[model samples]
Target chain A: MTDYTPYVAAVYGLALLVYGGYTLRWHASYKKLERQLASQSQESP
Target chain B: MNILKKIQPLVGLASLIVLAVGLWYVYQAPADFQQGGAVRILYIHVPSAKMALASYIFLTVASVLYLWKRHEGADILAEAAASVGAAFTVVTLASGSIWGKPMWGTWWAWDARLTSMLVLLILYKGLMVLRHSLDDPVKGARATAILAIVGAVDLPIIHYSVVWWRTLHQPPSLAAGANADIHISGPLLPPLLILSAAFILMGLYMVTVKARQIEASRHLDALEAARLHHDD
Candidate 1:
């Protein structure tokens, strides 16, 4: 009977924040690792 | 190109597109007669809850593969799944609590379903901690895998808790049995189903990205150790 637009929006907003934050963090970590591995390979020989 | 390079981009793009479409469906669906706009929360909450359990099952299976075949890749996958699973569980609990506040009139209750789901979140966190606690990588993987296998008992318990005990939580929504109560249909069901698929694809993409990160980390560790040995 009550409008719960705010509650529904909060859940979707939270989902976006959590998933987006995680994706960006992991993508950045992977890129850093890739760069490190590339540098190491170059230094090896 | 390697298999991962070929598949990861497509999977990532597909997840995003499907998730957008699923959101569109949710937006277009009419409000529930009883719960009004609040029912929209079910679109995210149900899929997240399902994915949380699904991810643990994936981790358990990967753990079995790692233990049976001595596959390092499997261990990496299990690790990736655990992290992703933990994220989904957090979403599930937080979203469920939001929904509960309006419907159940409380933030949380010590019910079987809710408590078991909480236990599942704990198990996932425990597995991650156990994996990193040991100095020896092999020993850490072994202990984590064993714990994963044993912790899988909670999966069945989580699934059946509502049916087995009297609880404030509602019975199964998608699952069918004597205890099944919710029969969502017409405009309401499509968004839920589509979002579930979208969540699975998104979960898979996250797992793959994490697996690559873990693989790279292990390689770096090995290289560092080898250099140390050579210098010594």
Candidate 2:
């Protein structure tokens, strides 16, 4: 059988990129929304 | 009030810990006797593929709920799941292609499973695009829900494609039907299960956070519209 270490590595790395990317994106959106909520409350009050 | 939003931070933390442990388990497992190092990809690939299908199922159920009740909450969930599902499907397709190139001697083929999965991805994109195009939120949500339910027929087709058709992709190993080329055996099973749980936790956290974000944005939009109207 051919050595597939590199392919294996690449797949694992890609998994990190995809999952990590989404997690970061979700956190950013949550932070932005929280800030918006805070500002909106202040403006209304 | 979904309880998930309240514990999003905890969910995120648990996912990280689980992912780390899963990776550790994977490294500790013995290499496949048949596929050698390539079998390591199963730790990531199988979980992703499972999540891709699961997220869509969640989306379909959410869509059905929305259709039945005409609630914004259900629509938000459907929308979030579709977007997350789309991302997972992309991972599934990409990782599968990568795994296939070495194992199958080709990057891709017009296999039934692959083709149906591509269609699911396209439907997800359609859901996202439709979300933005329609100006009225309720109308957009209703229309999208209809589309989701209709498109859901593809789910079973994608799942059973290998059994129903001659496909290069392997059949389900976790359940009975066709034989898989590589079995999740001995030390390998723990890491596979651990990674699956980690992915599921992450998937749940994302959809919950995303649904909350979508609702918050919609509320913000309404407030802005009210302010503009007041100014007028």
**DockQ each:** 0.83, 0.71
With a 3 Å backbone cut-off (N, CA, C), the pairs that clash in candidate 1 are none
TM-score (0 to 1) for chain A, all models? Answer: 0.86, 0.83
State the lDDT at B130 in candidate 1: 90
lDDT of 1 by residue, B1-232 (tens): 1466579889999999999999999999998776678778889988998899899989999999999999888999999999999999999889888877777667785545566778889989999999899999999999999999988975686657654664434454312221211545677999999999999999999998888888888989999999999999
Worst 10 residues of 2 chain B by lDDT: B172-181
Query: Candidate 1 at residue B49, lDDT?
Result: 86
- lDDT to native, each model: 0.84, 0.80
Model 1 agreement with the true structure over A15-44: per-residue lDDT tens digits: 998888887788889889989998998999
Candidate 1, overall lDDT?
0.84
Off by over 4 Å in 1: B158-181
Per-residue lDDT for B15-65 in model 2, tens only? Answer: 989989998998898887777777787778788888988998899899998
